[model samples]
Each structure stands twice: as structure tokens, then as C-alpha cells.
Target: MKKQQFVCTSMIPYPSGNLHMGHIRNYTINDVICRKMGIKMFMGWDSFGLPAENFSISKKKTPKLCVKKNIKSMKKQFVDMGYDIVWNKEINTCNRNFYKITQFIFCKLYKCKYIYRGKCISYWDKKDKTTLSKEQIIKGRGWRSGSKVVKRFTKSYFVNLKNSFLKSIIKDIKLSNWPETIKKKQINWIGEEKGYVIKEYHLFFNNIKPFNSLVFSFNNLVLIKKLTKVKKQLNNIISNKNIFYKRNDFIYFVGYKIVYKKKLPVFISDNINFKEFYHPFVLNPFSNIRFKRKMKRKILLNLMFEKGFNTNEIFFKRKTTYKILDWNISRQRYWGTPIPTIVCKNCGVYQERLKNLPVNIKKVKLNNNSDIIKVEKTVINCHKCNCLSYRETDTLDTFFDSSWYFLHYFCKDIRKSKPLDIYIGGEEHSILHLLYSRIIIKILNKIKIVNFKNPFNTLIIQGVILNYSYYYFKNGVKNWIRKINKPKKEIKIYKKLTKMSKSKKNGINPYKYIKRFGVDTLRMYILFIAPINKNFIWNENKIIGCYRFINKVLEFFRNKKNYYYHHHLKYNKFIIKKIEEDINLCYKNFKFNILVSKIMTEFKILKKHNIKNNNVLEKFLNNLYPICPFLVKSINNNFKCQL
Candidate 1:
């Protein structure tokens, strides 16, 4: 009988630098699962991204060189940790052969009418000179450059997401065995708003369009004619009612009036100094705020219709508008998958033929002034018209590189088969990467490229490792201050335990821990810290505890003279049963911490009982192999014991 097929995968990390504690935790969890289940595992680098480009620019080297150096270092680290990954199946998104598949998928999507070009407003960072995704923008600023982001309209390619498609995605999400928190986040990200769009008399105030203008009620017309004098009058009227304080910047109004053959109260309020309103005024009929005496828009529309008013001219039903926008796959940077499209003056825009795929990134020297558009090799002859044309200089977004990587892992020969059985990634990508991957798989399924709709049967979003981040304020600007050993009274240093990241300089390098305590000890320490899904603070003392446990196990196994055979053993039976129960529990709920604790307890019990049965000892070693493979291998090799 054929062995059951099981494939496990994880998010390919960007080769920005060395792996950190978070990377260790994520990969270790998946490695342990795959080993315990006896499944196939594939590992690769998400090597193409802005971080690599920035590093290349800073080092005055090509992105290829930078990526090669970083991947070598990172791969060594993974090997040192004894990850049970199939080295032969490694993939790098930056590789021409691998990206050929990505570009091929892009052409498929284009042919399916899921891809289009349009002018879109994007967050542009002037300092970095690149468009930033919503995820890359932090609190209205660029994440990398810390520059203020401004809106700019640019011609770009987008992946169209229809309302029906979104509903289908959401529907499929409910059927999957994903975390409730992640499901809810995807729902919110694809925000669906339902309401009617009623037309209002614009009154031609401040050049506002009069006909077909959206309004919540007819009373909004009164504010249109405001000469700035009407605002003061409304403010005074509200203040006289003792509803608002005089010192307040503005007062709220609930004025009722008749306009355009309808009598309804139009909710108006001052825009200045009002924390509640995001705009100058809140005018949506479906707004959360409700006036005590105001009638609903639906009721007012019915009354106007009864009065023989032309409903089409005065009001219309609202169309569903989704909050989630189409994905902008265009990026103005090097060190990414080049978009596989060519623009010809005679033939218009045309996707490169599959035979000419990959649109391999040309090797170009790096400089502070490097621009993809200025690169000479970017210009290419059109595949359709055979005329001089330019290749799409902009590279595909990094998210595109990751969106379908799991599927590629299962498609070694591009066969139609089920997707991977398990996927492990960070919760930070719950909305962006996970959602995009699911959508891409569905599209591929519709196009008959794949047999499955979902890529992974199960997804595990690992919790982030966090450390205490220290920073100081300098000249009214917050500066990241590292290496704070002791608090200084005059400096007013601030610190908070947050997610480990390179920008904050709070990430703990896994190499340090690996070198100091050995990979097995570091791995056990991370697994033993807390539950896999919860955040825990980094502590050196706990690492030492793990080191001691490993040494104790080593010492216990080395003394072969102390061993004795116990034929009838009640304690060994109990220990074996307990280990089985812990293994089951770990597989059931991903409670690796609990499993590690139980294993330690079992070791202590074995020592206390002085159990010397070889069969029992081998059973224990097999159970421990997944978590501490290197240590177990060393012990077995030295003692000629089978694990």
C-alpha cells in the first residue's frame, strides 16, 4: 500500500538578514509536526523583496550577490538546527526557473480577465520613491523610511475581486478549519456595506454637484448654502438650548426642513474639534448615530413616493461597495519578479507568451541612483507586433511571490494534485498573504490549473516572539535607542515589550543562542517557553534551565553501568502511556509547550525510578527525536543504541 501523502510548508522568509528567534519558533513548529507525522516537507526563501534591494544598495552590490550571501548564512542556520527539510526541493522566488511559473500564472490570470490596468490612488513614499502597500504603511507613514506618505495617482495593474468572488471566498473560509480570529479578520478586510444611495438637491454650494449627489436626507441641502454665517447661527441656536458649552469649537444640529418634495430631518454637525466625525460631517443614512425624532430614509422615501414624486429623479437604492480594494501588483523597485507584460505602440498592451516567460531580471549594477525604468535592458521588442516596445519596468509585488508558493511546493512536475496538507506562517499575514493565497488557488481551480480550491487543509499562524524595545526621544523625535543596560534618570528612556523586529533593534539573533547553548537546547527552550499560540517574554534564565536539562539527559544516558533490566515494570507502563497522551495532545491542539513539559517530567520520573529497560529507553528517545533530533542522534551514535 502507498504511504499516505502529507506535505507541510511555511512562509518563505525574505533574505534581509540572519534568522531571528521568531523564524526559529515558526520553522521548528512545522519541522516537529512533519517529522512526527512522517511527512514530506519543503523549504525555500522568499528572497525577492525590498529588504534585499535595500541591503544591496547599501552594500553597493547586486541584489543577486546580496541574496546569495544571506541565503547561504540562513541555510546553514537551518541545517544546524536539524530541520527535516528536503534540500533537493528547495525553491527561490528570485530564480529564473522558479519565477517562470509565477509569470506563467500571471498570464493565466490575465487571460481569465482577473487582471486589469487602471489609475489608482496609492501611498507613495518620496524618500524611498516607491509605492507602499496598506500593510507597509504604518500610522500614515512609510514603514521603512519613516517618511510621510502622500496620495498619488498612477497607472498600475490590479487583480479584480468581484463581490460574488469575495462572498465565495468568505463562504469557503467558514468551511475551513481555520482560527476564528483569522476568519473574522478576513471578513472585516473584505468589508461589505449595504445601504441605499438617495439623491439630494446639491444647492450648488462651493461648486458641489447638484444633480445625482448622494445624501442621507433632504435637510442636508440647507448646509449647502451656508455663508459661514449660517454655521454661527446654528451654533448659537444649539448653545442657547444648553446642549453644548460655549467654549466648545462647534455644536451639533438636528434641524428638520422640507426640500425636494420631502420633509425629513438632516443631521448636521460642526467638523472642527469633533473627535467623533472622521470628515467635516457624517451624512450617511446608515450611520451608527441615530436621532431620537428623526425618521428613517426608507420611511421618508415611501412617503415621497406616495405623494407622486418621481422616485428615480429624487432617490435610488444603494449598490453594495466592498471596502477591500483590488490588489495592486505593480512595484517600482528592483530585486523582485519582473512583471511579464510588454507594451507595443501598435499592438497596445500584451502579455508575454508562455514560451518567453520569467522576463528574467537583468543583471544591473547597484547605485544610490538606480532606477528600474532607467535600466537599458528594461526596453524589449513586443512579442505580438515585433516592434520596439518597453517591458513593464515595475516588478510584481512581493505578496505575489508568496501567494502561490505553497502550490508550487506540491507541483514539482506541475501535476494536478491536492495542495499541501499543512501550512505554517505568522499571524501578521492573516489578512494579506493568507487571504491572497486562498484567492489565487480558487482562481487557479476555476481555470482548471489545479484540482483543489484550498491550498492548505490546515494553517497554523505562529505567535510572534517579543523582546523589550528601548527608545529615547531626541529633539522632539523618537529615536530607536539600543543597548540600554540601566535606566538613566536624565534621559527619560522608554521601553515596551513588543514584537521582535530588526527596525526596532529588539530581535534576538538565533545564532547567539544556537552557538552558546547548542541547537537542541535552544530549540527546546523556545518550545518550552509557553503555548505555541501565545506570546512570551524572552528570558535567559529559562534557557539555562533547558541547558541543564539536556546535560542531565546526557549524563543519565552515558552511565551504562547503572542500567538494569526490569521485566515487570508498572512505572514504565505509566510513563509510556503518559508520553503517548502528550504526543496525541500536541498533535491535536499544537500545544508543544505542554508536550515539552510532559517529556521533561517523564525524564525526571525515569531517573527517579532508575529504569534501565532498553525498550523503554528507546521508546523515550523516539518520542524526543522530533524536538531534539541532533542531541538524540548524538546519544544514539555514541552508545550504539537504536532510536
Candidate 2:
């Protein structure tokens, strides 16, 4: 008979930096599942994108070097945690094979007419001279360089995902096994607004030659047509920009629909006579804007409800756009994978090919590549096209590296294969990264590059490692603070406002916690103190309680003189029934607290009676092997209880 087969995968983290406690929690839970379930589990690295490149640029190191260092550190941490990871399938997106496939998929999408070129208006860093994604754009003058960013537009490429093909999958896919919060978030990210809003506007055209050059900014920049005949009437009402104006002589009304990214525009009629040119569609609660034209580049993106339109209207009905913004995959940063493209002088256009990608490091000179070309990393125009267009140098979005990493594992063992199994990660990625991964999978599958119909059969999004900052005021000014002085704060104790990260210095390191307290103590304390997803403060005193509990169990085992019938016989069946019920509940909930509680209750009952049945005790110990493996193994090895 064939052995049972099971496939499991962990969402690879970008080697951004050191792994945090939250990351440890994510991997630890997965490791436990893999070990207990007795299945094949795989691990890989998202060793590509911005974090690696950014670190390399900052440290003046190569991205390959940075990733190597980070991977070494992360691997050591995982080993220490006792994770059974299949490291042979480890992947790095920076590799030619990985990105070669990514670019090939891009070509396939392009061939299918799902790819197009357009403009992206945003802050252009004069020093670094690149467009910044929303995350990379700081609230200062410039995120990378100190120079102020200016509003500049660039011609770029985009994948056209606004179709029923992608939309239908989302509508049809059952999220029953997934977390409800994540499902709701993914639904929101898809931005589906059910009913359509319709509006009609009357204006004379320059020559009535059927104007078709109209484009709308879903992020709120509207383009009005410049008509020759209606120029004066339009000029009196509408500015050179898309802003609105009202006149006493004549009245103008505008109408449009707020459509989801994947849906066609129906109609959303909002009649404004003389108000500002801003449409109600632009400002929404979730919407934020960073004006490329602003001098200081304030993150003035938050909606205040007083802007131009009602927050309800904007959020309830989002602007729908069939036109896609260009993929601004260019950056002038010091360190990043060079966009593989060359410009042709005769044709004055750019060309990119997959086979020639991931420029040979040894063949080209880095200094010369940096000095003459202004933009350090770049794509090239096709040498065959003879065009003067420069290559787009911006690297792929770092999120792109992590998005389909789980899929890669399925095919990692094969010479050239596809993804296997499911994606397991924190709840945080559901919005941007996970959504994009779904789109990427669909596009890849549609192109017939991979055989798999769905990227991941199952998705398990774990919760954050619930923790709280421990601080105490000194000098009577409420300023000076220390972590050790405070008591443990449970997630139920205090509501925190910020996420824990290295930059915040908000969490205690597990290494320090373990060194001070035993591993079992820390483990027991963490689970008993709070629910898995909520935050709690780390306190040594609480950990001491766990240590005491373990000591109590050990003492009970060691002190017994005889194991025959010294304890009570009446409650054996009743206690066993209760323990079994708790185990069933634990199987259903997968909750640590409930399992621990049941174990503790059983221990208390066993201790109340003299050491009675060894067989009963052995069964109890085996049941706890999932949570506290080390202690159970230690007891079995030393005592050798006869069942």
C-alpha cells in the first residue's frame, strides 16, 4: 500500500532583515502542524525585491551578499526552533531561473493583449531620480534622496486584469476554511461595488470627430476633453486642469459610474452645478493621496470628510477604470536587479526580452554602468528594434517576489515545474500581496505555463504573535522607561495602536526571554497568558508560574512510592471522559489555551489522588505531545512508565 501523501508550504518572508517574534510565531505554528500531521513540509526564501536591494545599497553590498547573510541568520533561527523544513527546495527570486519565468509570464500576458503601456504621475526624485511606490515614499522631501520630489509622468507597461475572468474566480471561490477577517479584507481589496452610478454630460466637441481619447484616474485625477468649438464654454466652466467651475450664464452637469477594478462602469450620477472640479468619486475613507505636485510632499492622503465630497459617496462608489496605469518598473537606486532591456538609437524606443535577462555581472562594469547612464539599474530597448528608447531600470515590486513563492515550491523539485500545495502566512498579506498573487496565478495558468488550475488549494493565514510593550516611567517626568520593571500585560489588558517591529523596539527578544526562563516556561506562559492572535506583555513573574507548574508535574511523577491503587478508583471513567471531550474540542478549535486548561485540570485531578494508574497517566502525557513535546519525551525517557 502507498504511504499517505500531504503537501504543506509556508509563505516565504522577504529577507528584509532579522525575523521578529511575530515571524517566529508564524513559523512555529506551521512547524508544529507539519510535525504532528506527519506530512511533507517545504520552506523557501523570498530573497528578492526592495528589502534586499535597499539593504545592499545602504551597506554598499551586493544584493546577493545581503540575501546570503540574511538567509544564514534566518536558517539558524529556524533550526533552533526545531522546524522540519525541506531546505533543498529553497528558492531565491533573484536567480535567473526564477525571474526568467516571471518575465516569460509577462511576455505571455503581453502577447494575449492583457498588457498595455500608459503613464504614472507621481513624485520623481531628482537625486535618485525614480518613481516611489506608496510605501517607499516617505513623508519628507524625498524617501531615498533628500531632494524634493516633483510630479512627473512616465510611459510604462501594465497588466490588464479588468475582466470577468479574474472577477469570476473571486466571486466563486469558497473561503469557508479561511479566516473571516481575511476574507472580508480580500473582498474589500477587490473593491466590488454592486450597483452602478450613471451620469450624462452635454458638451460641444472641437470637430465632433468622435472623441475617444478620454481617460480617468481611479485615484481621482479626471481628464476633460479640449474641444475647439466648445473651448470657450468649457474654459469658462472647467479649468486647464480637471477641476470644476460654475458660471451664471449657463449650467453644466457631469455624470459617471464608480466601478470596481474588475468590473465595467455602469453609472453614478452626481450633479454639481458650480462646485470645484473635484468629483465625489475621488475622496473616500480608505483613499489616500500623495500629490506629486506638492512642494513638501506631505502624506496628505487621509480623508477628512470636509475635502470636496461626502466620504460616504466616494467610498460607497469607487471610480471604475478600464484603463490601467503603466507599470513604473524603473528606479535610479544604487543596488537592484537591472531591468533587462537595451535602447536602439535608430528606432528611439526600448525593447525587452526574457532570454537576455539578469545581466551578466562579470561581463559589465558596475562603476561605468553607474556613472554614464544617470539611472544605475535599467531595462534596455531591443537591440533588434533600433529605437532610441531607454530601458526601464526600476526593479519588480518586492511583493512580487513573495506573491507566488508558495507556487514555486510545487515545481521546485522538478527540473522546471509548477507550485504545489497551499500558502500559509499571517493575516496581514490578504490585501495587496495575496490579491496580486491570485492574479499572477490566474494569468500564469491562462497562458498555459503551469498545469495547476488553482495556485493554492488551501490557505491558512495565522494571526500575529500577540505581544505588548513593557515600559516604566523614571525621573518623575514620564519619559525614562525600562522593559523589565513592568508586569506582563495581556492582550485583554491593553489595546495597542502600533504594530511590533525592530524599528519600534517595542518587543522583548525571545533569546533573552528563553535564557532567563526555560523554553517550556516561556512556551507555557505565552499560550496561557493570551489568545494566539492578541497582544500581551512579557513578564518574568508570569513565566515563573509556568516553571512552577512544570515542577509540580515533575514532583508528582518522582515522589510516588508505588503505582498500583493508592489513588481514587471512583472518578477514573468520569475524568477520562472529561479529558476526551477536551481533546475533541482542542481538535476542533486548535486553541492552545483550551488544551492547556484541560491538561492542567487533569494534572490537578491526578495529583489530588495518590499516584494510582500508570496507564492512565501515560495516555494523558501522550495527548500533550502536540503542545509540550520536550517535557513528554523527557518523562518517557527517564521514568519509562509501564502502560
Candidate 3:
């Protein structure tokens, strides 16, 4: 038996009709790195999503059919892009076999008491009847359905991320190779905010001792208008920034403390009050008008109680809520994995029997107009009793599918599976996907399902792809162009480099680019144009240089002959060493542009001198094989040389 050398994967693509520039950039980098590692990357699909389901409904096809078609087309494009992908090992989340494993894992976690049914705050789209992530809710509306977002507490399956895993993640995340900004975002999201809530007065304080003035977000306009200012800046503390930024602030009593002593501090507060308290304002004590003195929590509580301020007795309670609360794993859509649980009125909710795993909704019909699943509101009977029960129709969040997909590359048995050598993805996933995966891994380790706490040894975050958007003014109206080239000069045109979007209509159709310039040129030019981890504008003109370089390499291979050589000349070693250095630099800092630029420059020098050394040719071709495999294959076919 032989051990695997390295196991690496890029993020599994969503299998949308055509690959975007961002996909090209990510896959190209992954392909080159895998080639250098002498390992083949596995292509997988994140098949269950809203777009595919919606597309299926619009096309009058089943979701599975639509996904299969998209997957077929995308696989062809992936092969056309020259990626060394393992097609046989491919996994789809919507597949019965794969999601059976997903359901198994869900139940195993439930058995281990890692999952529980809880009420989670979610943004629900009434029209779609689906729960949306925070990002999916744009300006109090659903991004896709254009329905007014209604925030409500929904009963759903959730995992506790704030347990032992919280401490471990914060401690170990520092050792990761993630960017500082990304690390900061993760840390900030998993906030270590500790506070105490005195329900008697609706006051939330950060410190248990309350030595620092506690700032609760007060919404009482009459109270706010009546109070004297603690600081001049405190006058505007009731502004919209408090609501927008989720800032929790304290009240500084001044003008009429005697008149409204009971009503002042006992106002009921909502969830917005539990956030970390900012002590930007001073507190006023009944004894001290200056309000500069500090007192411990016990003293303050006793004084308030004795002074008869609102409450008959002091109620002191410590906070158990965390910033990462109610880690919801449920969605109300048809395209996701059904939550593998059951609810019974007589008995408590429990995992479905292993034999009854993966309550797949593929057979479930969809409403013609609403697009929501049309099925029996009630499902399986309670496993314990023959009592009336219902199956949990809410689907697992797509993140649950992605969090453990990497493990399926080897086998679902985490005890036998090894962590990935490297995993590359975009920075946009730095928050939810990255955090959730790590949390899932930690839970696996905690429950003794897996021996490891982390999923990968190294993680690479890819940058967003950017391009200059061209807009032409037609009859004094700005209209964006969908193609790469500028419009005819008869009309006025403007160009600006920005993020790509369909609404902007500045999207570059990769199929057209590949058809015109060849996929090899597009792959090479993407690597050559800029660093993989930094956003750079797409310049169609810069691709011409890479195109000509590929042509020159092919021409050099065709014009010359291959022969066995005992040793390379001294100058040849220098060029090969420089190539090795650049390759190392690429792996180190993600500077593929520098690597490609260095290779092209050296090849130009070799061409001018008419060098025919096998060492130089082999070195150049081997290095370039990752970036432009089709071009190298053409050369290999002509000369019958082993790359």
C-alpha cells in the first residue's frame, strides 16, 4: 500500500451555466498548484441552491434535471480550461448517496447532543417562503424575490458554536495563514463580548462589577429629550448610527432624575440592547450631581433597590448569550437537504432512524406560482410512539453541505480520513463558510467522530476578479456593454474598473473569450496579469502578450528537435534555477503574475539566442504545463516529448 502524497481542492463550483472570471482565476491557480504538487484536483458541485431551483421552475424542468444539465455543461468547460481534475471522485450535494452520508452525519451529531432544536432569528421572505441569510436581505428586502424582509423567530435545528469550540477557534485561528483583515473579521464575528443584564431596570453592562458606566441603547425619545447631556457628544447618541452600527450605549441622567426616577431606568429593551456597551457618556448617581464616581455592581444594585428606583428588589443575572447566537442550520426551501429530524407532540424531537435517513425532497412537488414545495405539511410519525408527528420540512443550510464536503473526497468515515493538505477559495467565504467549516471540524473532534480539529493544513483565499466596465451613452442615456470590446466610435463610450454584476451588464462572457482567444490564453493571461490574492482589472489587450508567448513556445517546440542530453550547459542551469525561484515565489506569496512574467521573459531570451538545450525546454514546458496545458499538449503531440 502507498500513502497519498498530497490532497488539495479548490472550492466546489455552483455549476452555473458558464464559468465567470472569478471562477477562472480560482481554478487556474488551483490547477497550477496541484500540477506542481504532482496531484490531481477533484471537481465537485455545490448543486443545491436557490438559483438552480428557480431556473428549473422557470424552465418547467425538475431541479435535478436542470442541475444535471448545468453540471454536464460546466464539466465540459472545466475540461476545456485544461484543469487536471478527477472526474470519477466528483461528489454532488444533491446526489442521494452523498446526501445520505450528509443525513447520517446530521443524525450522528444529534445523537452526540451537538445539535438541538431552538428558536433562531431569521429574515423570512413571504413570497418565496424561504429563510434568507443576512447577506441575502438587502435594505430590508429579499434580494432575489424583492419581498419585504420580515424578521421573526423561527424554530429550527441549530448547533452551538459558542461552546468549547469558540475558545479553541479564537486561540488556534491566530496560527492560520489567513490575512490579518480576514482573521480580524472572523474574530470580530465570534465576539468575546461579556455583559450582565439587570432586568429590573432594563440595563445591560459589559463588566460583571459594573465599575464602568453601562450604556444601553435607549429608544425612549421623551426620556432622551428630557435628560441633561453627560458630554456634548452625548446629545446626539440617539441618532441612527446607534441602530445601523448596532452600538449599545448608556443613559446619563441629568435634568429630571427626581421626577422620573422609577420610569427612567426601567424601560423594556429589545435584542439590540445586549451588544457590548460603549462608555462614551458619564453616569449620574443620586448623591453625586457630577456623576463621576464609580461603584461596584453589588453597591449599585443595593443602592437602587434601597432608593426604591423602579423595582422592589434587585435582580442580578449573568449573561449567557454570545454574539454568535442561534447558529441556524435550517432553511425553508426545497433545493436543500431536508433536516434529518422529527417532531412529536407526545415525545421530544429526535433524530430520524438511520434507516430513515435523508428525507430527500426530490419527489416533492413545487407550487406553480409560489415555487415553494407542495407536500404534506405533516411527514413521518414519531419513532418512539405511533403518535401524531411531522417531518421537519426545513432544509439544511447549504453551508452544512459545504462544511464537510472535503471529507467525502476520501470517505465519510472521519476516523480514517486525513485533513486536506491545502484548500483554496475566495475571501468572500472568509466569514460564513470558513467559520462554519472550522466549527464543524471542532464539533467532529469533540464528539470523537474525527481525530482532527482543523480540516486543512493550509488555506488560500483568492481575490475577487475585476474588469473595466464599458458604458455607451445612447441618446444621452448610459447603457452598459456586455462584451469585452468598446462600442462603435459613432456613440460616446466611458470605461470604469469595478466589480462585475449582471445588473451592470459589464460581465465578460467567458465562452466568447475562450472561443476567440482560446482557453489556454485566458488561463495564462489571468495568471500573468496580476497576483491571485489581489483584485486586478481584466485587460483584454494584456492577454495578447500571453497569447503570442504561447504561440512562440509552440513555434519553438515545432521549429526545433528533441534529443537526450547528458548534462545542461552552465547558462541553462541559471535559467532553470530562476524559473524554480519564481515558482517558489508564486507558492509563497501567490505571485503567479510574477512567476508567469519571469517565465515569459526568460523564454524570450532563450528564443533570441536559438538555444536547443533539452534541460531548458523541459524546465520551461513543465513549469508552463500547469498554466497552459493545451498549448503544452500540442507541443508534446508534435515532438513526442514527455512533459
Candidate 4:
């Protein structure tokens, strides 16, 4: 019989140098599962993007140097914990070889027209003179500079996900073993709208041919000619993201009647602007194509609004659609995957040739963004015009780097990789990160980069780690208390037990707990405290209980006197069979807390039975390895703990 093989994956840490409780809980869960299941696991670094750049700036050093230092510290911490994961097969996002693959995928998508240039509203920090991500904004102000964030219009790249593809995502995600809440988040973000709202007068709509693209009561051809001359008067009325159906807010335009079939181009106003349109098309919410006749352009604008325009009644039907916007993947930051694009004055936007895969990013000072060049080459010429062209300085949003990162692990045979057996990460990624990865994987499948569809078969979202931070308001500004000496009641009003974050100054170092108690005790305590998915506190008082349990287990393994030269073959089978059943049930239900409780109970039963068999000992030790590896390591090393 062929042996079943399993591979486990964990979310790569951002390599920010500060490994806090959140990282410990997440990686500990991953390590425990890998060890318990006998699955081979791989480690990688999510080394690109903002956090490292921010840290480097604060320390007055370069980003590459800072990231290199952090990776060394973090790897040692992982080694100290004895993860037994494959460190040699590690991949880093910022590495040239790794990002080469990332750029290749982007260029491929760009060639296929899945990627395009579009305009988006970006948040500009006036004080810092930089772009701030949605996360970097605290309320309406920049978190770093405390500058009020204002929207700036900029041309950017977008991965054009047609509406049809989005609906498929809505249907296909049900196959994965993800939390229902996470699934709902992706669906809601896509913003699928079902059926349509039409009015009674809209029934003038039987056969709709809506080719006209102008504000009419005016002739279609004449309106077009007149609009060229009248553009200045209608400058503010151009369609943008803000245009929606409300009389004052609406800038009426004739858009295609979006239907399942190629319905005729009908008169579709985007919900309320007939006051200036001079037509009573707003007589219903969404009208059926019914225009009486054409009037001259001069008379149409002068028509009185008091003459017409009234909604008779509402209408409804069962329909399906998606309102999802294309993905915006442009960032103004330096530490990210450089967008593999160039623009020329004559030829417009051009994708870099695939043979020249990575348009290498030249690292520069944090404040300086001008004259970003490709590798050592100072000037790159456009393929079409052969004239001096500019490289796209805007690096991709960091999320793009992570989108297909897991696939890089199996890049040699992405198709054979099937789907990642298990993927583990925090619930905070349920929206942006998970959705982007899933969609990018689908795009890969569409482009035949990967044969399999789903990126991960099982997704485990760990709950947030909550902790208390004492703080008080000072002159209308909130300040976190560095030293806590006051009584609980005195600080009660100011004490906040929120998710452990560096911003909140509540994140505790895991090594502190690891030093007091061993690594095994720390890992066991986290699982023993509550279910892995539950949001719980990092309470220090409960550490002693786990510490004592580890010491007891360590003593049993070391004492040779506890072993006997007796063989109870039949009794050993009975004990092993029962233990296997319990372990299976625990894993099946993800009841890790119960496994530790049951192990404690089983020790009493083992002492009572006095069963002395190596097979029984091996069975118990193997199952217990996840919770107490230090004790089990001796048995594994010294021939399976002889009875």
C-alpha cells in the first residue's frame, strides 16, 4: 500500500524583528499540527512591504539590512522552539529569485489583458508628502504623521475581474473548509446585487435599443455634435465613482441596460438627474426604454420640470449580478514588488518583456522617490517608439506579493501540488488577503499557470490574542501608561483589554514566557487554555499549571525504574486502540484542549493497569508529541520508550 503524504503551510511572518504573542500563538498552532500529523512543513518569509521599511526608517538604517537582521533573529527563535520544519526550502519575498516569479505572473496577466491601467482615489498625506494605505489611517488622520488624510486622484493598475468571474468565485468558495463568517465577508465585499428595481412606466420598455450616449430629448446624432461644443458646460457632470441615483447627486448619462442578454441600448439614467435632463425619465426608479420623440437641443434644456416626471409604482424580479470593482494594486511605497510596466510618450503603457522577468528595484532613501530606475541600466527604451521611456515607479500593493506566495513553494509542479492540504493564519486576513489570494489563484488557473483551482483545501483562522493596556487621556490626547503601579480600581476606567498590537503597546514578548517555562510548556499552555479559534487573554497566572505538568512528564521519561521487563501483549493492544480512538476524535473536532486533559487522565489509568509494553508506550508518546515534545523527544531518540 502506498503511504499517504501530507504537507502543511503557515502564514509567513512580516519579519518586523518584534516577535510578539500573536506570532507565538499562530506559529505554535502550526508547529503542533505539523508534528502531530507527521506532515512535512515548509517555512518562508513575507519579507517585503511597509512594516520593515517603517522600522528601518526609525532605526536610521537601510531596509535590506534591517530585514536581514530581523530574519536572523526570528529564525533563531523558531529554531529554539524546535519546530522541525524544513528551513532549507525557505523563500523570501524580497529575494530576486522569488520576486522574479512574482513579476513574471504580473507580466503574463498584463499581456492577457487581465491587468489594465485605470484611475482610483488614493489617500495622500499632506504633511508626510506620501501615500498612506487604508490601514495607516487612524480615523481620518495618518497614523505616522498625524496629518489629515485627503483623497487624491491618480492613474493606477487594476486586475480586471469581469463580473462573470466574480459570480463564479461566489459559488466556488463553498468547496473550501473555511469559516462561514469569512466566506460571507468575501461575498459582501464583492457586493452582488440581485434582481432589478423597475417602475410601472418603465414598461414602455418592450424592445429597447439604447445606442444613444447623450442627454436627450435631443436627436442622438445632433446631441453628439452639440455635446462637443457644450462640453465645458457639462464638465462637472462627467461620470465618476460618486455618481449614483439621487436627484441632486445624479449626473444623468445614457448607459447600456445591463442585462443577461445583449439587450438594446436603452435610455438608462444612473438614478436621478432629469431636472437638468429636461425629460421625465425619472418617472420610475429604472424606466423601460420609452422615449416619445426627439426635440431640438436648444429647446430640451429649457423644458420646464413642473410639466412631468413622477414615479407610479415599484417593480421587482429574481436576477443575479455582482457590483465588485476591479482590484487596485498600486502603492507609492519603496519596499514592495515593483510593477513590471513602462510608459512612453508616444506608445503609451507597455509591459516589460517576459525574458527580462524582474525589473529589479533599486533601493533608495525612504524620503526620495524620484528617478527610480531598473537594475544598473539608467535608461530603458520603449519597444514601440525606441525613445527614452520611464519605468513604472509605483510598486505593487504588498498584498500582491502574498497573493501567489504559497504557490511558489510548489512552483516546479504547481499542478501536482493539487491544493495546499492545510493553511493557517489570522482572521484579520479573511477579507483582503484571503480574497486576493483566492482570486489570483483562479486567474492562474485561467492562464494555465496552475491546473488545480482551490489554493487551499482547509483554512484555519486563529482568533485575536487580547490583553490589557493601561492608558489615560492627557489634554485631549490619549497616552498609553508605560509603567503600571496603581491599583486595579484606579486604572479601571482607563484599562482597555483589546487585541494585542504594537500600536496599543499591549503585545508581550513570547520569549519571556519561554524562558520561565520551557518551550513545550508554553506551546501546551496556549492550546490547553482554550480552543484555538477562541479569543482569549494571555494570562500569566495560568503558566505554572502547564509548567508543573511538563516537569511531571519529564520525570516519567527520565526515570528508568518506572520501566519493567514484562510483556502484556493483549493488554497493550487494548490501551493502544483506545488511545488512538481518543486522539482521532480530538483532532477531528479540533478539541486540542481535551487532548491534554485526556492525557492527564490516561496517566492515572496507565499506573493502575501496570501495562509494560513498548508498542503501547510508542502509541501514547507519538500522540503526546504535539503537546509535550521535549519529553517525547527522548522516546523518539532512544528507541521508542521501552516499557
Weakest ten-residue segment in model 4 by summed lDDT: 283-292
If both were scored by lDDT, which would come out higher, candidate 3 or candidate 4? 3
lDDT of 3: 0.68
What tens digits encode model 4's per-residue C-alpha lDDT throughout 183-232? 88778767665434332222222112222222332112323334332232
Please give, for residues 363-450, the per-residue lDDT of candidate 3 as tens digits: 7555677565555656565779988898877888888889888888876565677778888988877777888888888888878888
| Strongest candidate by lDDT | 1
Q: Go through the candidates in order and give each one's C-alpha lDDT.
A: 0.71, 0.51, 0.68, 0.66
TM-score for each candidate, following the candidate numbering: 0.81, 0.68, 0.80, 0.76
Question: Which is the winner by lDDT between candidate 2 and candidate 4?
Answer: 4
Candidate 2, residues 1-643: lDDT per residue as tens digits?
2322467667777675566666666665565556556664577677765445545666656668778888888788777655667777677776767766555555556667666545545457665556654334554355334445555556545556553653564663444345667667666545443322221111111111222112122222221121111323434534554434333222222222223322211111111111233332222111121122221111221111123222234322323322112234445443444444444557543335555654532222234234222234344444775443566555555555555666566564222455445456766666556666766666666776666555566676665654454333333212212344443543222234344554334645667766775556556665666656555544556678777888788778777634545354656677676786886577445576676778888888778765377667877776665556667667766676643
Off by more than 4 A, model 4? 1-5, 123-149, 195-320, 365-379, 412-417, 470-494, 560-564, 567-579, 608-610, 635-643
Candidate 1's clash total is 2
RMSD of 1: 7.8
lDDT, candidate 1, equals: 0.71
